[model samples]
Target chain A: MSGEVIRRARGAVAALVLVGLVVAPWVVDDYTTALLARTLALALVGVSVALLTGVAGMPTLGQTAPYAAGAYACAVVGSRVSDVGVVQLVVAAGAGALLAALIVPLVVHARGVIVLMITLAIGELVVVVLGRWRSVTGGTDGLAGVPAVRPFWGLPALASDQGRYLYALVVVATLVGAVLVLLRTRAGLVLRAGRDDETRLRASGHRVAVHLSGAHIAAGAIAGAAGSVLVVAQQYISPADFGFDTSALLLLGVVIGGTASVGGALVGAALVIAVRDWLFGVLPGHAPLVLGALFVATVYLLPTGVNRARSRLSEAAAPQPDPPAAQERATVGEVGR
Target chain B: MTAVAVGTNRIDPYLIPALDGVAYGLLVFVAASGLVLCFGVANILNLAHGLLYAIGGYTAAALLDGGWASLALALAVGVLAAAAAGVLLAGLLTPVATGSHLSQALLTFGVALAGGSLLVAGFGPDDPQVQVPATLEGSVMVAGHRYAAYRLVFIVVAAVLAAALYLVVRRTRAGMLVRAAVDDPEMVACLGVSPARIRAGVLAAAGALAGAAGVLGAPIIGPGTDTADTVLLLSLVVVVLGGLGSMAGTLLAALAIGEIQTLGVALLPAAAPFLLFAAMAAVLAARARGLAVRWRTA
Candidate 1:
C-alpha cells in the first residue's frame, strides 16, 4: 500500500497493456481485433478527455469537435492519397490541436457551466457545418471510403484485417505512451496543479490560463489522432457519428474508466464498448435504453471508476499487509482529484 | 434568405405570410414562457423542453383530430401532459441532479437523448401535421396579400398571457417567492417559504406553456425534428440574453429575437443559422460589460 509500490504497479500495468495491444490480434479473432481497433480509437478520445477533466479540471462535454475534425482530416487526406498514414495522422492531429487553440481563448477564462456551454456551442456549430455544408462534408451522408494507413517506406504491409488491427493498436500504444511521457514532465505537473487549484498555482507564479489552454490543445490533439484512426478503420465518417451523443458517450466512458489514468481511459472504453456490443447482440434493438441505464449506474456505483471495484476486490482477496504509507502517498498524488 | 424588401411596390404571395411572422413571434413568447420560468427558478436546463413542446403539439394534433370545440380544451390537455412530465422528472431524476449542473446536464441530456430516440421509435421520424382550428383557419387580406387570421388571434392571446404573467408575478405570493429566490437565495430561504415547492409550481406552469406552444404552433408550423431543435436553441438564446431570472428581459429579448430570426432569414437566406450564433456571440462577447452568470445548484 506504499506510494512507491503503487506508482511502480501503475507503470507495470501500463506496460502490460501496451504489450497486450501488440499481441492481441494473434490470440483474438479478427472480429474482436476490429472491435479492439474501435475500442482503441475510443480510448484515444477518452485519454484526451482524461487530460482535460482529470489533469486540468476542465470538464469539456463536447470533444466530438476535434474527434470529428481528426476524422474529417483523415477523410480529406485519404480521398487524395492511398499512402502516408503518418502524414495523414500528423495532419489530423495538428488540425485538432489548432481547433482547440481557436476555441479556447474565449472560454478559457470561465470555468464550470460557462465552459460547458461554450463547448456545447462549439459542438453544435460543428454539427451544423457537417449537416448544412453539403458540398465538402457530404452533408449527413458522411465521408466514406477512407483508405487505411498504408505501408510506408521499409515498413511491413498493413493490408490485412489483422495487419490493420495491429496498425491501430500500435498507433494508440505510441500515442498513449507519448501522453504518459508528457504528463510526467513539468508541464504535466503544472497541468495537474491547474486542475486542482489554479488560483493557488497562479499565486505561486504561473500562467494559469496559458497552461489551461495548452492542456486543451494537447487533449484535442489526442482526440483528433483517435478520430484519424477511427475514420480509416470504419471507412466512414457521418455527421451522426460526430453528434453530441458520441461526445457524451466518450465522456461517459472516461468517467467509467476513472478519468485519471491512461489505463483507466482504455478500460473505460473497453467496458463501455464491450457492454454495448454484447447487450446489443443479446437484446437486439434495446441497446440504447440499456446503455443509458448503464451510464447512470456507472456514474453512481463506480463514480470514481470501475478500477475502484477492481482494486477493492483485489485487496479483499489478497493476504493481509503491513502499513505501506509510502505507497499510499504516491497513490494520493497520482489520483489527482 | 432575402430581406423583405421594405420599399417594394410589387405584391408577392410569400410576403404576407412573412408579416404573420410577428403574430407567430408572440405565440412563441407564450410558449417559451414555461421554459423561461423553469430555467430561471430551477437553474436546471431542461433539455427535454422540446420534448414537452412536442408533447403539446401531439396533444393538440390529437384533440384537433378528435374534433375539439375550442383551442382552450386542447391547450389544457397539452398543459396537463407537460405538468405530468415535469412531476415525473422532478420525482425520478432530481435527486441525482440535486446540486451539480454537470450531473443535471448529464441526466437531462440523457433524458433528451433517450426521449428523442424513444419518440423516433414510437412515432417514426416524419414530420407530423395538424389541421388549423376552424375558427382561425381562414385568412384576411392585408397589404394586398392574404395572411392567416389565426396568427392575429394568437397575438391577441399572447398579449393577454403576457399581461396575466406580469400581474401574477407582481401580485401573487408564489410569484413573490420566485422573485425572492431569483434575487437572493439566502433571503428567500430565511423567509420560511419553501423554494423547492415553489420551483415545482413554476416548473409545472412552464411545462404547460411549452406544451401550449407545441400544440398550438404544431398546426401552423408542423412538428418534427427541426421544430424541437429550433425551440431548444431559441429558448437558450432567450434565457441567456434575458439574464436567467429577469422576466422583463425575457419578454424583450424573445420579441427582439423573434423579429431578428424572422427578418434575418427573410433578409439573408444563406446566412440563416449564423445570424443566430452571431446574436449569441454578440451577447457572449458583451459579457465583459458585467454580464455575470450566477450559477445556482440545479
Candidate 2:
C-alpha cells in the first residue's frame, strides 16, 4: 500500500476503536463496563510504558510514580472542588510530567540495571511518602470520598457504572490518540534513535538527554491521565494501588502487548486484566502462578510480543510492497537491543 | 564526673541499636553477597535472589523443630535447595545471556513471582518464624544492656562466613577462574575454560549463600509472602549502591545501609522508610552511575 493509503487505514482503525469504546457500555453488562473502564485506564499506563521503555529505550519500574501522582492530585483536587473531572485530569497530567521532570536528572545518565533500580527506588520513595503523609494521603487506608466524575461542568455526574465507563473510555481514547500522534513526531524519531544508539546520537551532536526527558515527560502525562481516570472509576485512591505490583504489571502489559505499537498497549492491558479477573474465576486460587507462567512463556517464546503473531499472519496474507530502504532503516534503528 | 556522665548518656542511647545494626548489616551482606557474585561473574542479575533467600528461610523454619544437629542439617538442606534453584535459573538464563538486562530482569522477575506464589500456596498467608535453638536463645550483657544472644551469634557466624568467602574467592583456583570470567568471559573461553560452567558454579554458590542467609536471618525478619520482594529490593539497592562486581563494596554498603536503616528507625520513625531510597538517590545524583561495573549493557 502507498504511504497515504496506509495512514488513512490507520486512522480508520483508530476511529473504529473509538466508536467501539463509545458503544461498549450499552453493549456490555454493568460488571464488564466497570472492568473495561479499569482495564482501559491501566492500558493507558501501558501506553506510557511503551513510550518510555519500548520507544525511548529507557525501561522503568517507576511509571507508578507518575501514576500515583495523578491519583493523589485527582483526590486532592476533588476534595477542594465539588465536581471537576476534566480540570482534575489536566492537573494530574501536569503533576505527573512535573514529577518526571524532577526525576529525569537522577536517572538520565544511568544505563540498564542502574536505570531500573533508580526508577524502582523512586517508586518506593513515592509510596513511602504517601504512606507517611497520612494527613494528606490518608496513609495506608487511602483517600476516600472522591466525588463522582463529571466529564465537564454541565454534564451529568458519572455516578453509574456506565457513565463512569464512558468517561474513562473517552479520556483514554483521547490520550491514546495523543500518544500515537506524539510517537510519529521528530522527537519520537530522536527517542527511537537514542534507544538504539545513544553514543551515535551524542556523536551526531544531539543532546540525548533532551530527547529522553521529552519521552519521560510524555509518559508521565499519559500515566497521570490514566491515574485520574482510575480514581474516578474506582472512586478511591490508596498507596497500595500504585505499588511495585502495579508498576510490574504495567511493564508486563507493554511487553506482552507489543511495546512498539500503540494497539499493543491496549491489547496487553486487556489481556492482563482478563488474566487477573477471568483467569481467577477459572483457576480459583492460582491466578498469580498462572500469570507468572504466562509472563515466562511470553518472554521465552514470544519475545516480540503477541502482536507479532498477528502481524506475521497479516503479512503472509497481504504483504505490502516495501522499499528496500525502509527495511534497511529498520535494521539500522534496532530499537531495543 | 559530670563530663563523663554526659558522655556516657550521649553514647548510651545509640549503643544498643548500633550493635543490632551491625548484626543486621552482617545479615544483609550474607544475603547480598551471592547477588553481587552472580552479577560480577555471570553478568546476569537474578531477580529471584530474594526467592532463594525465602526458600532457605522456609526450609530452615520447617526443619528447626528438631534438635541442634537437626537444625544444622536443616540449614544445609536450605542452602542446597537454594543452590539447586540457582542451577535451574542458570540453565534457564544461559540461552538469553547475551540479551539486554531488562529482559533478563523481567524473566527472573517472572520466576520470582511464580516462586513467591508457590511459597504462599505452601505456607499460607501467615508469616513463618523459626524458633532459635535453646543454646543461642538467651540474652547477653552489653554495657549493662541486654541483647539477644542469637543476634550476636548471627553476627559472629556471618562475619566468619564473610571471611571464608573472601579467602575462597581470593585464594582458590576455582575463584581465579571465576574472577577471570568476570573480567572477560570471551578470553576465559579462549583459554579452553567453559565460562558457562563457571557461571553456573558461581550461581549455585551464590544461591547457597543466599539460602544460608535466608535460613539464618529468617529468625530476625521472618519469612512471609513479602519476604522475597523485600529482600530483592534491598539486594538490588545494595548491588547498585556497592557498584556491580565489587564484593568489598557490597559488604561495606550493606553494613552502612543496615546501620542507616536501624539507626534511622530508632532515631526518626517517620523518616526511616525513606532512608535507603534517600541515600540511593543522593549517591546517584552526585555520581550518575554510582558504583558501576566496567561493562554494562542496559
DockQ of each: 0.16, 0.36
Which numbered prediction scores highest in lDDT against the true structure? 2
Please tell me the TM-score of chain B in candidate 2 relative to the true structure's chain B: 0.94
In candidate 1, how many Å is residue B95 off? 3.0
CA deviation > 4 Å runs, candidate 1: A27-31, A151-157, A302-337, B1-6, B9-39, B66-70, B117-126, B159-163, B225-230, B240-245, B248-262, B292-298
The CA lDDT at B64 in model 2 is 88
TM-score of chain B of each: 0.86, 0.94
Highest TM-score against the true fold, candidate: 2
lDDT of 2 by residue, A14-117 (tens): 77877887898899898888888888888888888878767776778899899999989988898786577889899989989988888887777655555666
| Alpha-carbon local distance difference test for all models | 0.68, 0.78
As for model 2, its CA RMSD to the true structure in angstroms is: 5.8
What's the lDDT of the predicted structure labeled candidate 2? 0.78
Which CAPRI tier for candidate 2?
acceptable
TM-score between model 1 and native: 0.83
Candidate 1, residues B152-199: lDDT per residue as tens digits?
A: 777777778888888998999878877766665546767887656766
